[model samples]
Target: MTTETSVDVTRIPRITHDEATAITAVENRKFGEQLRSLGPDDWIASTDCERWDVRAMAAHVVGGAAGQISPREFVRQVRTGRPIVREIGAKHWWDGMNEVQVRERSDVSTDELIAEWDTNSEKARIARNKLPKPIGRLPLLNLPEPVGRQPLTYLFDMGFTRDVWAHRMDIAAATGHPMDLDATHDGRIIADIVAEWAGYFDEPFTLELTGPAGGTFTSGSGGETVRIDALEFMMILAERTEGTGLLQHTLPL
Candidate 1:
């Protein structure tokens, strides 16, 4: 989770709707392909996401999308908090969902898991398209403070898209497979992250990230400057690495 900082929701710049949709498509294809290339040993590998393994992380991605498309059931689960798993320490809505998703898919084969992800990723993309513009302007509930109050557009564009991309990075790192990231598509993702990360601080600062996703960015007024590799900057944002100065302010991926 990122440090919570109040931001004017209206002032935030989002990738265009098309870009958001494209992100979903491209991320899914890449993620699916990466999974396909992994073996059974890789599926059980641990990731940076605390207790979740590769399969569990992938299950959350697919289950999240499945929940979106199945409103009646999803709403029921939210309302009643049914099928809760106390044994796994399911303390929150997402935690419970993550547990359920992994449990439900426990018997599923690796190939099936990859196929299901491809299907659900597409569904998540389509579901985003069907949302009313007015709905996009509404605040998302129960998100981390500051970020929690942001509009649905921010959640879809910044939150959801980044979740998959971050997890893709997680899987690649855990499996020792080189992850594929491009300048245009991946740069857009990193830039959005930088913009939000910038919003967390009161003083001015400059960030210089050098690599495929690298770029120059300014936040607030004149203050300290930090230079880092683009991937390392992301590692800081994802809280995978400790940072100094304004870099210490973590942002949700």
Candidate 2:
């Protein structure tokens, strides 16, 4: 419920390249399996995100998984967050999203969509792998959020990890598919992103978290106790699930 713009995030935690890559692989497998589980007809059905049917969603999900090269403008947006930047890719990225999107009509069989998705997803991964080493560290976003003058690597990791979890929700919402409880990158990237926002924006929210076993835990709240399920707490922070889901659960926050 809190949406303030000026936060002091100088103290937020950081993630290493090793951890991000490991978590991504874990989430991707869970999501890929979930996608593979769908019957041919199910992929063609409509979902909560309007204008994108299951097939389109599937393609978008897979396509989305493939990360983009960080543009100079994108870097600026993330750090300063002054003006919102539209997501863009290498030349014709627009055409692919708009023109190509229009060309792939529902009449296109689910099998075809699935095949294109498989192919494009591989392409996307290859594209990501080709980026510079520093960029590899960034979280991937379906639409990269703007942060000014800083490296896009941070945003990329945050966006990719969050999208992985969010899309799993999308699949579940659309098909009643059960979510892989351990599907996400343990919300590490998201937690960092939320923590960043907590500093970057003026939001009066406190996240009480349980870190990986034996992992250090820290918050800006001076170690005061706040009750909440770590995942639910993280979800609200990520703005994916309304904290309303926690009404029944005795959340510490």
- In candidate 2, what residue range of length 10 has the lowest lDDT sum? 244-253
lDDT winner: 1
What would the TM-scores of all predictions be?
A: 0.85, 0.56
What TM-score does candidate 2 get on C-alpha atoms?
0.56
| Model 1: how far residue 60 lies from native, Å | 1.3
lDDT (Cα atoms) of all candidates against the true structure: 0.73, 0.48
TM-score leader: 1
**How well is each residue in 1-253 modelled by candidate 2, as lDDT tens digits?**
1212222345545655556556656666666677778886667667655456667766655544332433442243233322212333323233244323323344666566556555554444344445677665454423323243445565344445556566566666677665556313544544455555444433333344443311123334353334565544554544445545222122111
